[model samples]
Structure formats: structure tokens, C-alpha cells
Target: MPELLAHRADTEPDRVALVAGDEQVTFGRWHARAGAVAAGLHARGLRPGDRVALHYGTASWHDYAVACTGVLRAGLVAVPMSDRLAPAEVRHVLTHSGATAVLRSAGRPDTDLAWSATLAEIEAEAGGSVPPQPPSPRDLAQILYTSGTTGVPKGVGATHANLAHGCTLDPRRRPLAHSTHFLHAFPVGSNAGQTMLVNALNARAAALTAGTFTPGRFAKLAERYAAGTIFLVPAMAIEMLHAKVHTTHDLSAVRLVGSTAAALPPAVALQLAAAFPAATIVNYYTSTEAAPAQTSMVFDPERPGALGRPTVAADLMIAGPDGRPLPAGEVGDVWLRSPVAARSYYRDGDASAEVFRGRWVRMGDVGRLDDEGYLYLVDRDSDVVKSGAHKVSTLQIEHALHEHPLVREAAAFGVPHPVLGTAVAAAVVADGTLTAPQLRTFLLDRLAGHEVPGRVLFLDRLPRNDNGKILKRELRQLLDDDRATQ
Candidate 1:
């Protein structure tokens, strides 16, 4: 990590490395500030390998970047915790990771202590020399966390080598090789956001964002900068497409539109194709635990639900109940062989054992590979619905619902049934009046009868996490509430 900053600082000192709205951080200043912070940490009696927790928001991207670099340069592990996290969530992460020091946005002045410091305090640490102890590529660099929608979030411990697997100082070999500027609105502390930070260090383009993401603002920023590559989560895609921002702004500058975090519905993909006529729409599939080991698909109308094939140098497989690899077209567990030495959950050997198998990472997703080797995700393990003797995919139902003219947003969850083990139910935010019968009719055309949602509830909006992932548990609770009322 230190080497990356030093290289950029030496070569492109004046070029902006990161942007949040109107503010920009140049490689020279960013690298220099990080060096000062590293000296400060050393003066404060923090030694190499000590865990430092950085709690910051998108608005504090500049400070966060400096802190992360400084921590790595000083040979310490950085634990990134977003400001959007709930207090309990924050406490859990801090406690579980055993972070010895905490750095947050500048709020007040405090003595530079080993336990805590502010961004202002860190910047005040005056020193010209780099910390004598710099990190090695194999040393732990950062501990990023998962979303924890189903339970407590797990901290993913990644070494510098893991994160810097493909990063290079060579201009021609940089990631996002085709773009001069890449735009995205992903939240801080997420896998997507961390990847962007990595890109800012290694990508050919200068990373750009609007800090806190709003669909309209994101679209405008891309237009304002004339970004050649744009990346976003599927939820952001849904909102932008819902507002038809393409008609409002000229997004023809984008040659590639990359969607991540979750599967992009086929309906949304079709809309994206028309919205950015010049762009090749792409769906990127990978979990926080299996990054640099996933698939990338250039949107093709011929393969409707495929999530593309494993990227260059990455291998993927489907596993049956016994954990043995399955043949093509057989639905089962999805796993990918990591491009680097596999990462593990911080201090949780049980979890590490369950998720990491040799160099392969279990995606915890139910999917299959076609004979053509394109991977199609059926559903997440928890999101799949068991309707009597048949297993159904909520994503299939959601994609079908998204195809409905009046459905603006949709989610599908399983509800307990009297006879069948579980029944499929759906919740939707409609652009206009849409009812159960109407949606059922719409689904019958696109889905199997067993796959059609048995119940449909209309709402103003679906509940979502800070990262814009729909809260299926909340939707299921709403279903239970409606049943109780009846």
C-alpha cells in the first residue's frame, strides 16, 4: 500500500487521485500527509501490527484516504468502519476486531493519544521522514466488513498482497484500462467502496464520486466530468432508471456501465442498454469474501439471466450437497478460487473454516453454470423459497416483477405455509395501481406457476440497508403482519 502511494506521488504528483464532489486530493499531498500521519502514530507509541480503527463517512474521504495510507505506511492494520453504521454495529466491530486506536472525523481537539485521535489531530503530526517500518506485501493491510444483513457482520482480513494482487505501476497495465475517469457512488466501508479506493491508487482513471449517493446527482456528476466508465450497485441502477436520468442527462460518454453488489435484473439491464446506447452494460458478481475471484459479464440479450463467466485467471465451480463439484446445468452452491491467497474472518476460525476452503471462497449463493460456462445465479441460500416439493428463486420472481410496467421496486421472500413447507410472497413499490391478480398474471407469462409469487403487497417503498440492498427480512415481517391482521 505504501509503495503504491509513493509510486503515484513520484510519477503523477500533480494529478488528482481522488475526488468527492468539488474537492480533490492529489497524489503528492495525499502521500505526504500519510507520511506525516505515520510519524504521528509512531510518536504516539503505536507500534507496527497494532490495529487502528478508522470511523469515517464519504464526506471524509480525503481524511480517510490519508489515515488508511498512514496506517499501512506505519505497518499497522486498518479497520474501516463507515459512519453510517449503527452505534451497536460500530461497537461490535470495534470490540470484535480488538482495535487498539480509533480515528474519526474532526469534531473536537484532543491530545494525540494512543486510544483515539481526530483527523485534525493526525494532520498536525509534523514529521518529514517515512515511518522506518513499512509494510510488506504479505502483511495484513485492512480489515473490511460484510453487510451483515442476515447477522453480525464479519470482518474480512486482507493482506496487502490480496488487495494489490493485480495492481501495477505500469500505465498500460492499470485496472479500468479503457477509461480516463471512472465514476461511482458506492458507500464507504463497503467492498465496492474499498475497491474504488484501490482503483484510485491503481486505476488509469481518476476516481470520482458525489460522496453521499443520490441517483440524480450521480448521473449529473458523470455528465459533468464526461466519465468514460461508470460503476454502481443494482439499487442505484434501479433508481436512476426509475427517474430516467439518461433522458435528462447525456450519458453517452460512458463506454462501460458496471453494476455490482447484487445481480442486476434483466429488465433493468435492458433499460440500461437503451439508456446508455453507447455503453456496454456489465454485471459484476462477487462477494466481499470472494473479490478478485468473480465473474464479469458484458450484457448480452441472447443469454438472459447469465452473470457471465469467471474473469481472467479465476476459476468457478458449482458444488452439490456433498461439496463435490457438480456438472454443468446442475443447481447448487457457488464457489470461486481466489486470485490471491484467500482471506479469512478476523479472529473467527470457525467462520474462516466454513467460508474458506484451500484457495476457494464459498459465495453462499445458489447458482449453476450453463454448458457455455456462463454462471446463472438462482438465488442466495436464504433468499431461495421452498414451495412444497419445488425450490424457487426469489430473484427470478423479482426480475419478473421488475418487468411489470407498473412495478417500480420489488422484493420476494418466503412465508410459512400450512401445507407447503414455505410459500412465495412478494412486496412491490408500484409506479401506478398494481394488484395481486395483475402481478400474478404478469408473472405467469415469465415464470413457472410454482415460481409465481402467491402473495403481493403494495408499498410506497421497500426498506433498504445503508448500502442500498433491499431488506428481505423487513419485507417478510410485513407479510407476517398482514397475515396476523387477516
Candidate 2:
């Protein structure tokens, strides 16, 4: 990573690389600061291969970027965590990664780690040099924890090659090349946010982030910077449309809007296209462990449900119960092959074995491929509701709800049913007055009789993780509590 920075700094010393609110960093300054931070870590007796947890709040984007690259420059491993996470949540990451040191930003989240220092304190000491031995391609680059919608969040480790596999030192070959400024509001510790940081390092465009993400604030930044490319997850996209920020703001400069982290509901895609008519809307599909290998779909009216084919150097396969690759149009486990050496879970042989099959990463999704090989997700294995004699896709139900004019956001899941083993349920966040019967009637038009959610709950907002993925587990708990009160 330092090698790339050094070259970028030498070549385009004054080009702005990062922006957040009032602060910005050029390639030269970022590289120098990163080098200095690398030196500070060395001075503190942290060696190559030692794991360091970076616990930074969303507001500390610049410092976190410097510290992360600096750790890479020092040939050490980085464990990125957001301060927005609870202390227990943060502790799980710190303890699970077996991190020897914890690096914090100014607004540090409290933790009990023995060795901890703020980036501000570390930067105060200016007395070391870049590691002569930068991390090799096979060296562990970073460990990012999953969203933990299931049990505990597990750590996924990516090597330097995994990080740089699809990356080109030349900015011209970088993805989203036709942009002057790239804007996103992904929290710094999430996979989406980490990818944006990588883009700042090598992409032709300068990266922009909001200290705190509000739709109005994000729109203002996009308007102010004239960001040609905007990257975000579906929740943010829905919020932007709900807030109607684009109506008031000049979003005419945006040429491309990329959505990821979860499936972009087809209705939302149409709304996004109408909102940003000048931009091409693309949905990117991949997981933390399966990154660098992804399938991206541009909005096509003809194929609204397709996720896309395996991108440039990536491969996709639908594997059956026996783990053999399934033919097209067959729904099975979705697996993606990374262009670079694939990543694995840290210190968990069982999890790694279940997920990392040979060179392919099991995406934990049930999907099918069209004759043309475009992927269409069926449902997450865990999210599939076995109701009566049918298996229902919660994603399909959620997409159906989103089709309604007043529905703002929706999540569909399964609840226990004495007769059928499980029953379909939905929790919706609506923009205006809506009744359960009206939504159920609306869904009946699009979904099968069994797919219609039997129970519905209305909420002002849906609970989400830092990465903006819906927490269905929490939704189930909420429904249980709501019913108990009734």
C-alpha cells in the first residue's frame, strides 16, 4: 500500500485524495503522514504481523485513513471497527481478532484494552521511518468483522494481494474511471467504506465522505463537489428519495450512482433512475469474504431482478446441496470466485471450511442464473420461510412492499407457526398512512398466496447495522414484543 502511495505522491503530489467536511488530504501529505504513523507504530514496539485494532468514529475519516495505510506501511495487520458500535460489540472485535494494540481516533469509544493510544497522541511523536519490508502479497492486510446479524460477528481476513488483486497502480485502469469526485456515506469501518478508502488511494477521482450522514448533508456535499460518482447502500438510497433532497439540490453532476451491501429493490432502482436521470444506476453484489470478486448490474427494465454476471475477472457458480455446480436457471447456493487470492475467516477452521470452498467463496445466498448467466437471488438460506408446503423468499415480499407508493422501507421475515412450522411476517416503514390489509392486498397482486406476509407491523424506522443492512433478528424480537403487549 505504501508503495502505491509513494508512487502516487511522486506523480501527482498535489492532487486531492480525500475530503470530509473541512479537512482534505493530497496524495503527498497523506503518504507522508502515513509514513510518519508507520514510524510511530515501529517506535511503540509494534512489529510486522502484529494485529492492531483501529476503533474510529465516522467523523475521523481522514485520521483513520492515515492510520490504516500507516499500519499497512508498517507491515502490520489492521482490524477496523467503528466507534458507533457498542462497547460490548467493539470488545468482541478487539478480543476476537486477538489484537495486541487498539488505535483510536479523537472521539474514541471506550474499551479495556491494555495498550491503547489516540491517533492524535501517536502523531505527536515524529521519529520513525517507513518499513523497508512492506507487506508481501500473501501477508495479512486487515480483518473486517461481519455485520453479526446472526450470532457473533466473525473476523474475515484479507491479505495484501486480496486487497490489491483487482487494483492497478495506474489510475486509468481503476474502476469508475470517468469521475472527478467520488462521494459516499458508508461508515469508515464497514466493507463499503473500506473499499472507498482504497478508491481514494488509486482512483482518478478524489473521495468525499460526510462526517455525519444526513440526506440533506450528503446531497449538499455532492452538489458542492459535483461528485460524478456516488456510492451507497440501499438504505441511504431510500432515505435520499424519501427526503427528496435531489429535488431541492443540484444533483445534475452525478454521472453514476452505485448501490451495494444488499439487493437494490427494483422499485427503488426505478426511483433512483428518475431522481438522477443523468446517472447510470448499478447494483454491486458481493460479501466481505467474497470481495474483489463481485457481480454488478446496471438498471435494465427488461431484467429488473438480475443481480448481474461475474464482473471482469471474477467467476460465479450456483452450487447444489452436494456442492456440485448447478446449471443455469437452477436455484442453489451462490458462490463467487475472487479475481485475486480469496480471503478467509481469522482463526476459525470450521467457518472457513464452510465458506471458502477451494478458490470459491460461498456467498450464503440462494440464487439462480438466467440462460444468459445473469444471477437472480432467491433468498438468504436463513431468511427462507418454510410456511405450509411452500418455501417463500422474504426478499421477494420486501420488494413487493417497496412497490407500493407509500412504503418507505420494509423487511420481511418468518415467525413461528404451529400449523406450517413458520409464517411469513413483515415490518414496514411507510411514508404515509398505510394499513396491513391494504399492503397485504397490494402484495397479493405481485406475490403468490403463500408469499403474502400474514402479519404486518408499522414503524417509523427499521433497525439497521452500521453498514445499513437490516437486522431481521431484531425485527423478529420487535414483533414478538409488540404482540405480547397486544
Candidate 3:
């Protein structure tokens, strides 16, 4: 397994690792705390491979760090469920994961399931000073659940080696010391969130993690802490733009501003770039089962859809339906082979086999590689709108709609139809006075007739998950409701 803070503490004990709210923890203290937590878990009869659910927020980054570190050190698998999940969702994940124990926010019993606090308190009482056991690289470190865009949530098993490789971007260039603080607005338990945590630890950077995305509060916290770096999802960036909150903070201390978890539209990207003029704005792309594909450093208006080039060790390619690798400029399914990929989905052999092809994993995303090797997403395989004889990419149309001066966000989906078999429908968020006709006119010049959305539904905002990915299922429901009313 990857080296924990305890290892680092043995070498550089004085370095600060976490700076959350008014709390500060040195590497040595953090290591000891993790060991204590691990000992507590072990005493409660937890064993290797046992699932330990963590429902804490990012507000206390060190709490999660210690808890997750403890889980790994105890040889147990950490299952991080989103704090934003509903009670039903929480129970489903808890029962599905077979969690023997759970760690949640203090006194937030309402958020926990039946008998959650009692179990945690019992484990907490078992706490004592103890050294952590070393783990092998192949040991299962975490089991992350996907957003379940297609169906029910599936657990993706990640190894320590995978975690280690995914986190480190530039080992050759060391980052600023721990005194340099960062504000983390992303979920601490998500794949991207874990990756950010690893990056911070490797750089010895201090972090002030928040619970939710309150753009104004987050910006104010960044100013208060003089944050040196931050990682945001595109949706959060959009919120920052809408609230005009970034300007309220002293963001001058920020040197790096990274975004991922969802596609970054050209308009939102440019707004982020203009807002953080000094910081490098990186538009990243990756799936829950695979490592990040690219990191776009320079956001240009002309090449808005590009997800940039591969990070370090990822081998990305486009594969045709027949499994043959597609040449550059050909649109096909995106395939990835990386040391950072998950071993397989937990206890899901059939599901695992479907995506994991021994070494390489099929990302289930359609995209193309430019002549320069930059990857551009077309859409998800399921999101392909098949109407009569035409196979239209909803993402391409969504991109075109987003290009409209009035449109804020757009999602195109296929609705069932008797005559054409399926029809294309769109849901949009807009600010200006652009009508459906105006939108159709704008898209006419950019997209083909078959690809244009048949209906345009406007909403206050696009529904999204915790990772900021638009909920197409919800969009399809909205269309179904509209049809019933008619």
C-alpha cells in the first residue's frame, strides 16, 4: 500500500499535514490519531477486507484523513458514501456494502441510519495508542460507488497502488510546503476528492476542507486561509460565476485551480479562466472506474470540447464497436489502460468483466482523439439519441446549445416514440431572453437537422449529483411528465 502519514512523520515529524477551520495537525499527531482510530476499529472485531463506511463531510479534512488512513492501516476496506445522500440511498449503500462499522460527523445522528451512532461510539471507546500494520500494494484500499447513471450503483474496488499512481501528477517537481494551504470544496470520499487529498499530502500542503458548495462562504474561507490551491467541479465553477463570489475573496494566493468530475462547457471555462487570471485552470476528465484521462491547462474558445492530454501513465485510445482501435479523428468508445484503474467492482464478477478487460478498462464513454492526441468526448453510449435511422450525439448538440449566448447549461436525451422509435428532447438553463425559436436558429448553423432537439424545456438549473454530473434520469422523467400533461 502507499505510505501513510505515519511513515512521513518518522522522517519529517514537524510538518503540518491538515489545517481545517481553526484546527492544525502535524504529521506526527495525525499519524498517532490514525493509529488510535485503527486500534479502535480492530478491537471492535473488524478484520481485513471488512467494509467500514465513512459518512463524514469535507469540512474536517483531517478527520476523514485519519479515518480513511485508519481503515487502510487496519487492513479493512473503506467505503465512502456521500454525505448528501438521502436516508434511503444511505441505507442502500450501507446494506449493499455490508459495513461492519461507520464513522460520521459528531452528533449528526439524523443523517445516520439505524443503530449507526451506537456502533461508532462502541468503536470509539475502544480507541488506544497503537502502531498501524503495513499493507501490501495490492491490498484493497477503497470501494467507491458510481453515480448509477445507467442503473443501480456499483462498487469499484481500488488498490493502494492504484490510489498512489492516480494521485501523484508531477513527482519530479515538488509543490509548496505544508504552510501553503488549500480549500477543498469537493467530496472527500469521491475518486477525484481522494486524488486531491493524495496530491496535497505528496506536496505537504495544508488543506481546509468544506462540507458543501457555498460559493460565497467557500470564497470567504479561501480568503481567510490565504489558500494556495483549490480543485472545483464545473458545476461549482458555474455557481461561483453566478454568485460572483470569487471576486469577493483574496484569491491572489491561489496558484492552481483544477476542475473535473463533469464536462466543462466553453462559457464556464472562460469565466473561470478570466476570474482566476494567475492560477492555471485545468479541465480534467475521468470515470469512477478509471484514472483521469487528461488535464487541459490552456482553455481556448476554439477547442472548447478537448479534455487535453493524458496526465502521466495513462494510455488512452478510441475503440470501434468491433474492438478495433480507432485512428485519430475517429469517434468511438473511449478505452483506457492505467496503473491507477480499479481492480474490479466489489463482489460483482459479471459487472466487472463487462468493463474490465484483464488490463484495460472500457470507460463506456464515446469520444475521439485529435491529430495532436487530445481526447474529446462525444457522449455516453447510452446518451446516443437513436431516432429512426440517425444516431445523434446528445453531447455534441449540448455543446452547441451551450455556445448560445443565452443558454447556461443544456442536456439532450432521447424520448420514446411510436413512429420514429425515439425522439430527441432537450432541457436547458438560460439567463437571457432566448426563445425556443432563437435557440433552434442558433443550433441550425452548428448542428444537423436530425441532431437538433425537438423540444426545449427550460429549468432554473440542471439537476446534478454530488460529483456535479447532470442527472439525465431526472431529465427523462421531466419529459415523461410533460407528455402526460399534454
Candidate closest to the true structure, highest TM-score:
2
Reference-based TM-score, model 1: 0.95
Give the winner by lDDT: 2
* Per-prediction backbone clash count: 0, 0, 2
lDDT of 3 by residue, 1-486 (tens): 236465667776777777776778787877776676777777767778888888777676667777888778788888887677777778888888788778777765543443344224534656553534667778888888888767888888888777776343343454654237777777855788777667656775676676667898789878887887777887788777777887677788777777878778777788788898887777777777876334454576678778887654247778998878989999899887765544688888998888888667788889998888888888888889889999888888877887787777788888888888998889888887667777888889999998888877888888887777888889888865543211
Query: What is residue 55's positional error in candidate 3, in angstroms?
Result: 1.7
What TM-score fits each model? 0.95, 0.97, 0.90
Q: Which ranges of candidate 3 are over 4 A from the true structure?
A: 110-132, 166-173, 176-179, 292-297, 311-314, 480-486
Candidates, ranked, lDDT? 2, 1, 3
lDDT of each: 0.85, 0.87, 0.75
Look at candidate 3 and give me any clashing residue pairs. 1-136, 1-137
Structure candidate 1, residue pairs in collision:
none
| Residue 261 Cα positional deviation in candidate 1, in Å, after optimal superposition | 0.4
Give the alpha carbon lDDT tens digit for every residue of 1-486 in model 1. Answer: 789889999999999888876788999999988888898888777888889988888888878888888888889999988888887788887887778888888762222333678856766764544476678888888898889888889999999888887789887788776766899877778888888888899987898877788878888999888899999888888889888898999888899999999899998899899899999999999888998787989999999789998765238889987889999989999999998888889989999988899889999999988888899999999888888999989988888898988888888899988999899888888897666887787788889999887877778888888777888888878875553211
Which is the better candidate, 1 or 3, if ranked by lDDT? 1
Badly placed stretches (over 4 Å) of model 1 are 108-114, 128-130, 177-179, 312-314, 480-486
Q: How many pairs in model 2 have backbone atoms within 3 A of each other, for residues 3 or more apart or on separate chains, i.e. clashes?
A: 0
Query: Could you tell me which 10 consecutive residues in candidate 3 have the lowest summed lDDT?
Result: 111-120
lDDT of 3: 0.75
